[model samples]
Target: MTGIKAPSKRQLNNYLYDRRREKFGRAAIYLDELEKWIFDGTTIPDDENEVFVFSYHVIEAEEPSFRLALSTKKLLNIVCSTDILHIDATYKLIWQGFPVLVLGTTDKNRKFHPLYLGVSTNERQEDFQMILMALKKRFCLYLIT
Candidate 1:
């Protein structure tokens, strides 16, 4: 052993979530880090960091609805070939108060694979339409391939 005392569970929890809750309490700064990683590609593991941010839109409302997409070429190809998609939305009431919409499909062998995720403050039709439009525009190759 290095003679270093391990942090208590409470200490770890405070270090991770409590600090974040405190900082994010002021404003909607939650997506800033994600934006950096997505836009600048500034995170570890060159292989995994090669993420393409097809579209990221945020509405600056009192309660904002934002949409973010992260996907790779290989995943898009798989999605195109699968030709089937499952879209579902789940509300996370505790954090961010936004509903997350997940779009996914299964491979040839019927293995499920998530294609994209979109988060919106409300589960309105327009929000979903916008998300779906973005996906279609970005992955239009599916039509031809």
Candidate 2:
């Protein structure tokens, strides 16, 4: 059996930062493409030099709800420093309630890929489980013991 190798503090932090950057870059590209499609009715070529307009429509749709839901999800910072990996909604609300999940990592100073899952609603067990499964699949032993 392969033993689990714990990354050093620096290594973990670097990994986390790299992962964060990659995710942000991908999201930016996706948003840019989406905007181009919306405005020009054509797909934009994926290039680093591409100057894509970023509009409030992208942020306004998701940011306020996330900030509001954060009050309820109350995801504690397990590691010293933390990062939010992804934020998403699971379903439409019956009432005024909506479910949101935040995935990320934590550590004292430099933690790498610590999984934090949060849900806006009270019944978040399934959401949490899904998050854990997704994390395990992506990070393998980096997440599991």
Candidate 3:
């Protein structure tokens, strides 16, 4: 081949799936272990509402079409909730180092886990707004039912 071979659709999907599992699966496992520690009294909290912030640094951009330059980086945060956990994924601006939220959710125990996560340089505002809106919608729904 003259250049790098493009992955077929199936291959691409498999790669993405594996990446997703590696990232989100580890997070889930950590949370489960933390929960156990809390129940077993291994971990102590100063307050009733113990909030833990876990972050992961994404080295590689999952999507290239987003026009993200080489300097771009991504970060994901997980926060504990009463019924479910809240996840927020965003891209850190290279210059200002401000997060541009790309995805946010209140996923059930294990459902709705991310399978393909990425950041886009184009339409960052729109992406951030969409995720915020989605998170609000989910939170409202959770409150109702």
Once fitted onto the true fold, the runs of candidate 1 whose alpha carbons sit more than 4 angstroms away are: 1-49, 92-95, 140-145
Give a tens-digit lDDT track for model 1, residues 1-145: 5999999999999798877878766535566655565566323223432456556666656774566666655555556566688888876422356666777997678887787666666677887787678777866643333
Compared with the true structure, what per-residue lDDT tens digits does model 2 show for residues 4-105? 887899999989888998876632334455444446522222442332221112223454321111111122222223344444455663223545454555
Ranking 1 against 2 by lDDT, winner: 1
Model 3 Cα lDDT, one tens digit per residue, 1-145: 7899988999999898899988867423333454343345423234333332222222234542221111111112231233443434445433123343323344556555331132333455655454444344433322211
Best first by lDDT, ranked? 1, 2, 3
Ranking by TM-score: 1, 3, 2
Collision count for each candidate, in order:
0, 5, 0
Q: Which candidate is the best by lDDT?
A: 1
Question: What are the lDDT figures for the candidates, one per model?
Answer: 0.64, 0.39, 0.37
- Tell me which residue pairs clash in candidate 2: 79-106, 79-107, 80-107, 80-108, 105-114
TM-score, per-candidate, Cα-based: 0.59, 0.23, 0.24
Model 3 regions more than 4 Å off: 1-3, 26-44, 48-145
